[model samples]
Target: MVPERRRLLSRRWFYLLLLLPGLLFALPLAEEDLNAIRSVTDFYGQRAGKRMQAWRELIQRGKQQQWDEKRALTEVNRFFNQMKFLSDVVLWGKNDYWASPMEFIGAGGGDCEDYSIAKYFSLLELGLNDEKLRMVYVKSLTYQQFHMVVAYYPTPAAIPLILDNIDVAIKPATQRKDLVPVFSFNGSHLWLMKERGQGQLAGSSSRLTLWNDLRSRFSSEKLKRPKLNLDD
Candidate 1:
């Protein structure tokens, strides 16, 4: 190969090399758990058809992307949002039930929070930075109801990208004028989203009863693959 072509190829390989450790760091899931997820999704695909196929494809896509953040976010967002938007009342007979990624895809239906939660974890599994991702609580002026969506901040000060089940297209927070952000959280810290870079620490995430419960369930489902985070 030409010297310039060789240098370019070397840089590409170097970047992929750097991506490897982060991918391992991001996926705390156990081998058995990953296998179990694969098996269950396989069964769903065979028996339930399209819904199950979507789940399987999501897993495959995550693995194939090899820690490409932009592609991972776009694919994961698209995968879960495609599911039918059924309320927790209709799906779980409760006003609110935070379904794990497995449970959400298994049922093939869920509300807005479910979509955001599933997308967050799936992106994490694909090695996207957890710091860049948040589950945002918002009030939907259009529907006049409390809602949830995933927000991706490429930089600390960049306008967040909104990943919503209700909207098929990914949009910047500025464009989504109809929805107002109240607060945001992830596996780490909960923030009082009053202004940019001015988030006050709310409290230990354990205070979020349902969020704590959901993370516990995720740990169990993943066969106790080491606690991700429980406190600051």
Candidate 2:
């Protein structure tokens, strides 16, 4: 009986030893994964903070400039002309979904969507009416993939003026049917352009949810880093 009891205790000790090495290895890997997640979160948070700061500054400057609609539109066009359109590097780079405008402004890089998004927010800050502006997502004719642009519609029935990085000139939306519209969103709303159709209001609940999400997620701080000649 004594011999049997001693053997059982010895077996339990052996099992404990076997488990120790595996746990030791797993701990480091777990720590590394946690650290990676933290790093990504921090990066996005910092970028968002920067974007918010930029928006504030831009708004203040716009107020000081006292630009009327015509002058503001001209300035916007000039600015678009100077900016290098979104590069493939910026398009493919993995980053946060809601990239603060500040990140784009800071890095001097962005994709088509980034340019449209930034411009849309900037125009809004400069006093462009929310109802008149939208960020349109579409399938590009040349690239055969998703792309985006800001469209300005003066009236409900009027064709929108396209603000695109692919072309320097602002053209009528009707002329660009090659761009199949997927959806359109703005600072305050989202539209199911292809299905619900353009000019019709989206569901209030959906619009409110979208508006809140965008408001909370997007930041204009990157613009504050330093003014780059954003003129196209």
Query: Candidate 2, TM-score vs. the true structure?
Result: 0.59
lDDT of 2 by residue, 177-227 (tens): 668787787755667675323745575424544345445654322222222
Give the number of the best model, judged by TM-score. Answer: 1
User: In angstroms, how far off is 154's CA in candidate 2?
Assistant: 0.9
Going through the candidates in the order shown, the clash numbers are 0, 18
Q: Of the candidates shown, which would achieve the greatest lDDT relative to the real structure?
A: 1
lDDT of 1 by residue, 17-111 (tens): 43344454454445665665565445444222334334545555468657477777777776676566787876777888898876776665678
TM-score of each model, paired residue for residue: 0.73, 0.59
RMSD of each: 13.4, 20.8
Q: Residue 137's C-alpha lDDT in candidate 2?
A: 78
Q: What is the lDDT of residue 144 in candidate 2?
A: 92
Which pairs of residues have clashing backbones in candidate 1?
none
